[model samples]
Target: MVFLLLSLVLGVLVGILLPFHIPLVWGKYFSVALLAAIDSLLGAGKAVYEDRFDFWLFVSGFITNTFLAGLLTYAGDRLGVELYLAAIITFGVRIFQDLSILRVYLFKRFSTTGPQGVSKTRPETK
Candidate 1:
């Protein structure tokens, strides 16, 4: 649950920073988004590695963002620097990714619950 929320917050931050060329954009949002994403990713990776470490996620985020930041830097267009848009894009991508992963798990579990072992008719009201 916390992971999902963190992903969403990070995505929002991503959106904020993505429009780096927009002069009037709020720097705070973008910065927060970037920080949140990195922090969340680090926490997750640390949990996976089971060592209370965060280097992996930090490295991965740094590597991915280097390319992303460079692309935005070169664009120099108002559209290219809009944080809101970037956040929306990030949120959409994460949501879809999670949904797809969930779909696979749900399908697998449902497939195993054959008709004979599962309830069919709805329960009667008391």
Candidate 2:
């Protein structure tokens, strides 16, 4: 987890420092790839929280998801159809579901708890 967090921060810093711009014509591919990346990142986060993270799985899944999404986008362009939406919808739903589960996990872990089962942040009632 420390490694993942550090890597993310480093990547953000490098991206900020480097000022790279993707071509406008590649926007569809970029969007799909971005969604795939977010999906993998969120999935990895949930897996880490659940104590089931696998480095190889995360790496392979990220590569595979991005490749497939970009391939579908390219194929749709060739066939005059919007096939990338499938990847978007699928990843989007998974992202939302993972976020929901993570939220529940976080709430259960941190909500209204204090020493000896008391809630430190809860207000006293009359």
Candidate 3:
């Protein structure tokens, strides 16, 4: 998680310092791919917070989701069917859901009361 955050910060800094632009024709693909990547990252964070993180799974999911979202956008362009909407909606919903879960997890872990009282209290220290 620390690595992920650090890399994200570094990547943003690099992107800011660099002036790069995607072709207008491929803008949809780029946007959908970005959304998918964000969803994957948030999902991975949620998994880690839940103690079910898997390195391989996170890597695979990040790559596959980004690729598939881009592919869907490309295919939609070819078919004139707007299938990218499906990818966008799916990833957007997942991102929000993952964020919600993470928020609850953090609040429960740090606060006196848990969400719906699901969080366990730490034993009193001697």
Candidate 4:
């Protein structure tokens, strides 16, 4: 319970802080993509193992991230920061955040598949 709450807080913090650094041109979309990658890599992997509220987890994360992003963007603008810079920063952080996830995705694709009859490949997390 504590861990889940902490994750939510962290996600919110990221969303809030992201717009301050990202450029406005592509901040929102990039942040959404970043959240998607982070959610897929961290959230989905666990969903495969834990039979719990996976649907709500993803939706909640999406909602919180977007809400925070918008709030922070508004705040940053009020603070006189360039919205474009903030958007760029958000996109940059988002891209950096997905590096490990992308690595694993690529590694899984290049490595091998599951049993001959199976179409899915399990992630090698170690």
- Estimate every model's Cα lDDT from 0 to 1: 0.51, 0.86, 0.87, 0.57
Leading candidate by TM-score: 3
Better of 2 and 3 by lDDT: 3
Q: Kindly indicate the candidate among 2 and 4 with the higher lDDT.
A: 2
Tens digit of per-residue lDDT, candidate 2, span 47-86 = 8777778999999999999999999999999998999999
Candidate 4 residues lying further than 4 Å off, grouped into runs, are 1-53, 82-91, 113-126
- Preferred candidate (TM-score higher): 1 or 2: 2
Candidate 4 displacement at residue 106 in angstroms: 4.3
Output the number of the lDDT-best candidate: 3
Regions of candidate 2 where Cα sits further than 4 Å from its true position: 1-10, 112-126
lDDT of candidate 1 over 1-126, digit per residue (tens): 578689879977997889556454545445545544554454444343333446666667655654454345345344566454554466456545545544444454457563553332222334
What pairs collide in candidate 2? none
Worst 10 residues of 4 by lDDT: 114-123
Q: Tell me the tens digit of each residue's lDDT in model 3 across 1-126.
A: 478789999999998888887789888898999999999989988887767789999999999999999998888889999999999999999999999988877777778766565675333345
Which structure is stronger by TM-score: 1 or 4?
4
Q: Estimate each model's TM-score.
A: 0.30, 0.78, 0.84, 0.41
Q: Rank the candidates by lDDT, best first.
A: 3, 2, 4, 1
Judge candidate 2 against the unseen true structure and give its global Cα lDDT, from 0 to 1.
0.86
